[model samples]
Target: MSVLIKSSLARKIVMALSGLFLVFFLGQHFIINITSVIAPETFNLWSHFMGYNPLVQYALQPVLIAGVIIHFVMGFVLEIQNNKARGLSYVKYKGGANASWVSRNMIISGAVILAFLGLHFYDFWLPEIAYKYIENNPEDATRYHAETVHKFEAIWRTVLYIISFALLALHLLHGFASSFQTMGINNKYSSAIKTFTKIYAIAIPLGFIFIAIYHHLNPITH
Candidate 1:
């Protein structure tokens, strides 16, 4: 176990596994978030459950954070190691001929995605924490929908969210297929995997973007 941990392949394996975990999270999160547009009451109920459930709060939340941090840190490390090994940027490069733009620029997209996540935490997560822990706000699930609508009222915030989701789609387009490749799943089903990855990448992010836009435009008309 220690020997595997010391290997380069092991680091790649960890990054791939973490990336896959995040992919699963994205699907779940997108489904839950999109509920705001389709079914408000159900959305609130689920949001309350997620926020207040002891097991999710204590165990799953921490695991999710660790997975994200490990993936982010390992990605940066791998990029740095690869660059150092190359010793110089490619001259007369034709990487674009073989690889997609997202594949070639994984590190850049990953960095931007990380920045976008920070903004998300600032916009929603931090306030939630402060409300729950610091200000001692009531543990009321009914208020979540109103809070969500109010935040998207700002055009600029909505725009930033759309942009981030677009970039996230690009990031996932590469990441989903690449993680499978890293796990040695490249075989006759590779084409199918790529097809599924592309669809998921576009659909999930677009779903979130639509949610932001919908809330922003149709803000709780009473």
Candidate 2:
């Protein structure tokens, strides 16, 4: 069991499984956020509902935190192991020989996405939970919501979101197919599976980009 845990294959499996879980979470979050574009009031209501749901929070919050830490740590470990095996003098191998560009740069893209997540948490989650719920600051709570609205209204923020979403799409493109392969799904039908996953990868991220643009152009009136 100890040997299996330290093996490269085992680490890859862990990374793939945790990554796939995070992808599912992203899909749900993207769908919920898109509501802000279609109906701001409905979005706010849904957000409030999610915020107040203790059962949901109790179950999901810890899972989310664990998923993030596991995914990030596993990725770094895999990369370090690969680097050590290859040695500093070794030429950087081309992933196109086996994987996509996104797969090769998973660490870089993931780091960027993580940075964005920090900003997102600070701008949205921190205010929603820490200030509104814990600190009991009604004024700061309202300001937080207004800040989100204002941020989305700005062209710069919209552009930043679009760029981040594009990176996310790239990350998903490789991650989706790789996760399936890691899970031992490769076969003659692998091509078809990869194609479908590609479509989903592109569609979900584009959907998020569209929502960002929509909200930026038509800021919601609170």
Candidate 3:
């Protein structure tokens, strides 16, 4: 385990795998959340099930959180290592000449995403924990839709969400294709895969932004 952590190749592989896992999770989350726009009842049903399900709450949720931690931690580690290497090796390394903006500053975008996650967990997850565990409130399956909409009623939060999601799109623009490359996926289909990733990178974050803005504009009343 220690040896693997020291290996840059191994770390990149782990980062790649964890990134792929999060991508799938993000897609699943987007699917469920999009229903809040198209079908509120369906969204409520899915949210209630996920919130109450033992497997999700007890098992999968922890794993997902750990994946987020691992991916970010490894990202920082690799960035630090790369900087040290560059300092030693490249006397006149030009970042703009060598790498694209998104690729060069993944850490900046990642930091924004991390901060957004903190806000997100504060808005939803902590309230949930308080409601269910601390307050010991009875499960109200019908409450999910209203609560979701209420969270978006704040225009500041809605705008922040949109901005964060735009940064998320930027992050994904580089990350999606690079994860495949890190996993040794250079082949005939690599070009096609990059194209698909570019589409997904733009689409998913735009979808999330739309959801936030929609709920903000169409707040529930009474």
**How high is the CA lDDT of each candidate model?**
0.86, 0.77, 0.91
Name model 1 segments beyond 4 Å from true: 1-6, 89-96
For model 1 the TM-score comes to 0.92
Give one digit per residue, the lDDT tens place, for model 3 in 1-99.
466456988889998999999999999999999999999999999999999999999999999999999999999988887677567422234565758
lDDT by residue (4-48, candidate 1, tens digit) is 336667778899999999999999998888889899998899999
Q: Taking the tens digit of each residue's C-alpha lDDT, what string does model 2 give over 1-222?
A: 466445989999998899989988988887777767666666776676676677767888789989999999988888887777766411366645765566668888888888878877876777667766688865321232345567787787788778888998888888888899889996899999999889988999899888778767767576
Candidate 1 residue pairs in backbone clash: none
Error of 1 at 111 (Å): 1.1
| Winning model by TM-score | 3
Which of the two, 1 or 2, has more TM-score? Answer: 1
Please list the residue runs of candidate 3 whose C-alpha ends up more than 4 Å from where it truly belongs after superposition: 1-6, 88-93, 96-98
Q: What is the lDDT, from 0 to 100, of the residue 152 in candidate 2? A: 87
What is the descending lDDT order?
A: 3, 1, 2
Candidate 1 at 28: error in angstroms? 0.6
Q: Compare candidates 2 and 3 on lDDT and give the better one.
A: 3
